[model samples]
Target: MERTLSSELNTQQVSSKSAMPLRLLANLLQWQRRMASRHQLARLDSRLLADAGISEAQRFSELNKPFWR
Candidate 1:
């Protein structure tokens, strides 16, 4: 029983370690997407901004946010 428990714990630890890279990749992708969206948001003209119901202040707020956020 002890051996079985130890083996299971080891497997779980290995699985979690393997998942870390995938998690970091996912986070990097998300940050990239956030950066792209913020860039597009910054390019919007006043008319488009109004149409989208986004104020200049709101756009500034979003644009100023860190990609990690």
Candidate 2:
């Protein structure tokens, strides 16, 4: 009975540890999708940029900036 309990505890601990990486991967995927969307928006013409109140200079800056920033 004690061995069974210990095994179950170990299983739970392993699952808990794995959960973190899974969550991180999910977050990474979400950020990737958002970055793609941002790039698509940035590709728009100057008229759209003006309508969005985002200047060409700002768009250029954002395009050059790192994704993490």
Candidate 3:
């Protein structure tokens, strides 16, 4: 009975530890998606800037600013 309890506790600890990596993987995936979106937006912004006669350097400078502003 004692051994069984010990094994159960060990299993629980291992599962909890494994969950951390899964959470980290989820976070990494989320970050990757956000980065992809930002890249697409930057590409679109560059095109728009070109249409507006803005230089590439100026577009990059403006891109450094927050999107909401």
Candidate 4:
């Protein structure tokens, strides 16, 4: 079997390595969205929270989570 530049570049290890930075960025964006939603949750009025079925304790727990989580 012979290897070509294109084939080598498409290998699992190389492709995974190439995607690492993009995946990290995507993960960070998702984390930021989660954190932002949590911040929004902290600002929700009692009526809205009740409508969303989120209790005060639940909202507090989510809002307290670290962005890395």
TM-score: which candidate is best?
A: 1
> Can you list the residue pairs that collide in candidate 3?
none
Poorly placed runs, candidate 4 (over 4 Å) = 4-10
Candidate 3: lDDT of 1? 44
Against the hidden reference, what TM-scores do the models get?
0.94, 0.59, 0.49, 0.78
Which should have the higher TM-score, number 1 or number 4?
1
Cα lDDT listed for each candidate: 0.96, 0.83, 0.72, 0.90
Model 1, 1-69: lDDT tens per residue? 356888999999999999999999999999999999999999999999999999999999999998999
* TM-score, model 4 to reference: 0.78
Q: Deviation in angstroms for 4 in model 1? A: 0.8
Return whichever of 2 and 4 wins on TM-score.
4
RMSD of 4: 3.2
Off by over 4 Å in 2: 1-16
* lDDT of residue 12 for candidate 4: 69
- Tens-place lDDT digits, model 2, residues 1-69: 356888999999999999999999988987787689678877899888888898888888778766655
Identify the superior model by TM-score, candidate 1 or candidate 2. Answer: 1
Pairs that clash in candidate 2:
none
Ranking by lDDT: 1, 4, 2, 3
